[model samples]
Target: MVFQCQRDSWARQFTTQVVSCCPAELQTEVSGKKATLQGFHVILEDTILFPEGGGQPDDRGFISDIPVLRVTRQGPDALHFVQKPLEPGSEVQLTVDWDRRFDHMQHETQLFIPGQHLITAIADQMFGFKTTSWELGRQRSTIELDTPTMTAEQVVALEQSVNKKIQERIPVVVTEFSAGDPEAETVRSRGLPDDHTGPIRTINIEGIDANMCCGTHVSNLSDLQVIKLLGTEKGKKNKTNLIFLAGNRVLKTLERCHGTEKALTSLLKCGAEEHVEAVKRLQNSMKLLHKNNLSLLRDLAVMTAQSFKSNQPFPPHRKDGDSEFMNIIANEIGTEETLMFLSTGDEKAAGLFLLAGPSAMVETMGPRVAELLEGKGAGKRDRYQGKATRMSKRAEVQALLREFTSHQSTEE
Candidate 1:
């Protein structure tokens, strides 16, 4: 059987206080040219305030006595949702959060740095510039110059030019324009959408940067404080990637770097400048010591091989340092008649067996011997190596080898 559950539609409704208002106050609903706070409603005659849109944050400010919490956009209407809802049709003075708005505006206006640009005929009327993205992370910003692409040298030159403009403290002028108007031509030529119903806001910094945008901005370039171009990378074929930091964020990053350097110096027991050299020296010494140890084991294996008796297999045993010694002995024998078996007795025992016998003997019985011992082993041509988690007794290894040789002789 299937069961269905009903969903409540109005379960998420909330009532909030309208604290602050935005400049979009012009479209606010009002009665008799007076702002009233009757019901939870706000009415305004006209407003120049901007709303949050296109990745830009909403303006923050206080309205009357209440602070503006957030700015929401509904259709073409920018709704300034306040902390506390005000009465409808009540006459009241409105204020905007200018500091936050100005910061957003400054960030958006700084997009037009001089550089190489490209114009692409994407579709019928849709054209996007293949340009460099200068503003990254916090705000992904890009600038499309008149040129298609800039060379590596050209990019360096453009970077210097943009930073110079930021330092010059050029004033950022914000103006509005309508379609068919002369000012609107600037917007049209740049391939930006024209707003004929109302004035289109344009941000221009004297001969340096100009673009149409609705985000809040700073009044002057000096307010930017500092501009830092971090790094650049290749984006699309004709486009480049640019990373940058501005004002307060850059200062904070500098402070973090200094702190990290101090910690590293204390841990490494060396000055910051000498830390890298000290690490390299230590690594080189360790490598040399490892080579010398391997050489000594190779010499010991030669002496051990000479002690083996003819026609008898050696039982494997693991001592504190048997693993390296066994491998060395296996290498020294390098014969087709001798088999080496070694093991060690510890809390957790282990064993290693190496076989170098008649090719026929190993081929027929190697797999069976490995299986009976409850271990894993493999053979190639006339040789085999087996490893056991628990060491095998000396008699067990000898019996397996004897049976293997006898089975091969019988088959022949």
Candidate 2:
């Protein structure tokens, strides 16, 4: 069934022909100064977007300038949210952001939890602890244990036993066959559907853990860099979350920490070990200096206000470029009014602003002021600040402020 989009601005309705062009139709919403966009919700007749199912993350993508934050399947439909508005009925192309998707796919494919390890360990202990459980987590495989509790001593012993196997460079083979005997050469792992019939897949890490699994895995045990056991905690009744990292990732993380330490030491002009203390001392000193500066600025503002009131031959000097002094005065006074403050210096860009005040100036004409400025900003009833990037003429800002004040009075 094909549906055409129609516009009803009152209904906040916008239409596009994206549904016919691609398998997915995307929607977007944009707002504010930083222009932080969030939305690219795809509504497709049918889609490839996977639901948050089986401990896997959703996909992300983009359309035009809009970034798709998340893609999820609702029943039979897929919804995509974007950062900005897209034209209705326009055939816009869509692309899935693959970096995130690939990482998620890799994680899903390599969930190497420790069900088989625990079971085999139990069997081995009963039969004289002859078999070994390799450190599967070291190879980029996420491993979990099903047992409720294991002591620190036991974990250390297990790790030692597993690493010994890695030094042996064992073969990890995957195969499929009919399920029959319990004491066969292979065993069934988890992740199989409930309604299974014949060809069950089995993973055999020779002289180590062997179980059935349908997930993707690397061929050799040596491909795993090194399984460094981070920590472990007891789970519901008889399960344990064995937290660890695999292979080159752990090494990379350690290297990153070392690099950060060196960079921070150089930045702080201190030795690596003294960096933290130096930073803390510098922070304390800066805070004290800032307080002193603020006190001086407040005294100057009071004196300046008095001069303005008394007409003490103080010329309205154009301050530094970007009018940092004007901003300072606004912050200090904390007043909301249609106040016109100007700063002039040999600067390049004319940064024009339609600054709103705490009083009536912002309440009525803030939005209209922003629209006139050819820039975008929004604020509450008390205060607002918007800029005119293109308004290079110094007189234009004064003109807009005057126009806004005049229009505001007439509207009132």
Please write out the lDDT profile of model 2 over residues 1-412, one tens digit for every residue: 1111001101111223344222334333446333344344556433333433334455555554556666554443445655455554565545545444444433332343334433234324433332211233223333345456656776676566655655566766766565664454446444544544446566667766676654334455555545555556655556555555545556766898899998997798888889879989999999999878767755665555455446632214343323344455455544544344333342234343435355566656566655654666666655565554444444555576677667767997
RMSD of each: 14.9, 14.6
Candidate of highest lDDT: 1
Query: Any idea what lDDT model 2 has?
Result: 0.49
Candidate 1 residue spans exceeding 4 A from truth? 1-50, 59-70, 81-106, 112-136, 139-156, 188-196, 275-412
Tens digits of per-residue lDDT for model 1, 1-412? 0000001111112233333333333334456565523222232333333455544555555446665555555544445555366655445454555544444554554553222111111110122233333332453344433334445565555456555666777777766666557866654233543322455556666654466555555666666666555555556555555555566556667888789888878887899898789778878888998777677756766666665544335633445435567656766675566544544344145555555555666666666556655568888876666765545444665677677566656986
Clashes of each: 42, 25
Q: Pick the candidate with the highest TM-score.
A: 2
